[model samples]
Target: MRGFLASSIGVTCAAALALPLTLPTASHAAPSPTREAVPGSTQSLALDPLETSPGSTSTRAAGAPQEQGLTRRDVRPFSLVGVVWDDPDAQLHGNVQVRTRTTNTTRWSTWQDVETHNDDAPDLDTPERAAGGLHGATAPLWVGDSDGVEVRVKAEEPEAERAARPATLPKGLRLELVDPGEEPPQGSRAEGADTGVIPALDKKQTEDELIQARGGKSAAAGSRPFIGPRPRIITRKGWGANEKLRERKLGYTKTVKAAFIHHSASGNNYRCSQAPSVIRSIYRYHVKSSGWRDIGYNFLVDKCGNIYEGRAGGVAKPVMGAHTLGFNTNSTGIAVLGTFGSSKPRAAAVKAIARLTAWKLGLYGANPRGSTYLKSGGSNLYRKGKNVRLKVISGHRDGFATECPGRRLYNKLGSARSSSAHLQGR
Candidate 1:
């Protein structure tokens, strides 16, 4: 029964494949000419000048002088032709005859036979055979003779690869390899190494170094770390013409215990180049328009797999942001940068989310094993009435009626939970 089912499916797929090629279109009625042949003794021919159809008139004079037995006057009616054969050892044999005429003079005819031999030829190589030959294989080709002179043709590599290779290092950057045990001379610092090391750096400098180091580690681990834009400290005194918006007080909360995950609902079309602008826009929209003090999410993940800090981190208390319904007081909401209900989040986003969640969970000292204050049984989590225990990584919809996270992304909550568990060594 299984074999019968498999055969039926295979036959259905085969029929689907055959349907497209068999279907006819208006363009199919008049097939475009690909190649053309002209009467000539020349070793090479240019088909672009040839007429598209027979009986097409040429603008050149009929009494033009002939070169290599080829002229507009003596040229035969050219037509597009395709040569096909069952075996690779197939020859293309044809003859071109030129006839000369003058007023009140006897017409003279001359013939030139172009015969291609169906045998192994060194120069006449096809791309498929040449490609195979690159990996230690020989390609056979059928050679042709034009006017008793052997004509050779061969395929060459694509133009892109033929271009010169660029230097490895950037213009100003030079790299040198050092031996395993090699060290700089005594009391001598390396060229690019920093000598004056401060015991402690300012808050901004410390944050910058930490972010840079984390970015380096993330690159090495094939993951991404959250790196926010340069901290633009807002003063208590408002700045600029939009003084009313700036004067608006930013909201605050007691503490953040958990985080809510959400999809942007709009597709993953946010440009990575404009990430900083997008972050600022989100903040303005949340604060000015949504009547919230700051961006709703604590962090945002972009499609190119970059994680950005949404809410500032060093505040003494958690700032209130709208992400979850009942759990907003304890949850530090994180909204990923795509419409997840329609599209599956990329692997990088998943990894970044895992790392960020693990870090946040550690900071809050939240226990994954402990019963989650948020309820878990719903279409958003499992299904209604399922009665699952609250895991550390729970969906926004797991606790409330709102579809804070989309269906496709909500499914990955389990994976996030597992990643958190693994990171926590639970």
Candidate 2:
């Protein structure tokens, strides 16, 4: 499935290491939704009238299996889209397809599938999950800049065994149109380049920054400590994140013991230069459309080997993220920015995963090639409080019963693990 969300009261709203980590103190700011203040905006539209299968005379009752969507219509210029519903626990058992017309041309693209199993979320019962206004959401889709869109969602039939009852579509479905907005102006921050990317750092330099960010503390002493050189990363500010869109207070965990890999499932039609825009779109979707506190992933790696900061918080800190559903407490999430169910992921992207995991996991003295146990908060795969053993670097499916990160990319985790461990000098 592909991933992609927007505005008028839309839906609301990942890491760490093991040194005697000096966790950042939690600070709160007044809750605010300054959507109009930012260049980017979301346009939330309620899904339109229901439709029946062609030639079928029967009408769909309020709770019956049904199809819902909007006719082709003009909308604010948006680069991404997704469908959301009122109940976060509701399952959308069906298909969601959309076609979009280019911003200025009469051209309309063929219908594309939006992944419906978006169960990859914060662990249940956590403060983030408890936050008000959460919703059931499909994976956001990156559709590029477009001014017109048409969408349809159809509920599938129940299997023969369960045929006694049909699947009913979720309630209050809404279409989220998101504009990532313009990229930040050149030279937006001292630490950022004109292209909005932060430069890579050598091992020593990274260690220094890591120490500085951690209140002048150093990692546990070792003659030959394992740590990888920091990869070049695009900061949230560099990518033009509207800080005001997310909740002011950042959440954190005690330590990061695992890294869950995911594919944004937002398709692979984007150019490398457009990645920042894609990140921004996903950020808005997660916050404005889905009602989460911030973007779900701790970090995002583009197909070109470029890494972008995901959820806000110091990159080196064990900032809590809303990535892996049941095991988010002690883990970080890294999403590669493209669908990889059948299409192979880029070599550069795979390498970036290795490089990033090596550095981030190493902070907690974790071996990417090793395994760790995380207690399940709750998920379809694991019961709440269950102790599950998983690799330090595992795919999204490892903790949740969903085909996330995608099959092609999930198959490459072994190689990424080996390379990451090697980079950490393990």
Q: Which candidate is the best by lDDT?
A: 2
TM-score of each: 0.39, 0.88
Give a tens-digit lDDT track for model 2, residues 1-426: 000001111110011322226554353343353323348889999987666768864437533567789999999899999999999998888899999999999999999999998866776877777877889999999999899999999887546623566556799999999999887775654453333455676777556544544456556546445778777777776778888788887787778899999999899989988998999999999998888999999999999998888987656667788988888887899999999999999999999999999988877778999999999998888999999999999999999888998999999999999999888777
Per-residue CA lDDT of model 1 for 86-164, tens digit only, reads: 2322222222222223223344324322112211111112221232211111111111111121111111223463243
Off by over 4 Å in 2: 1-20, 24-37, 59-64, 157-162, 189-198, 207-222
Q: In model 2, what is the error at residue 379, expressed in angstroms?
A: 0.7
As a whole number from 0 to 100, the lDDT of residue 235 in candidate 1 is 14
lDDT of each: 0.37, 0.81
Q: What is the lDDT of residue 156 in candidate 1?
A: 23
RMSD of each: 31.1, 6.9
Q: Pick the candidate with the highest TM-score.
A: 2
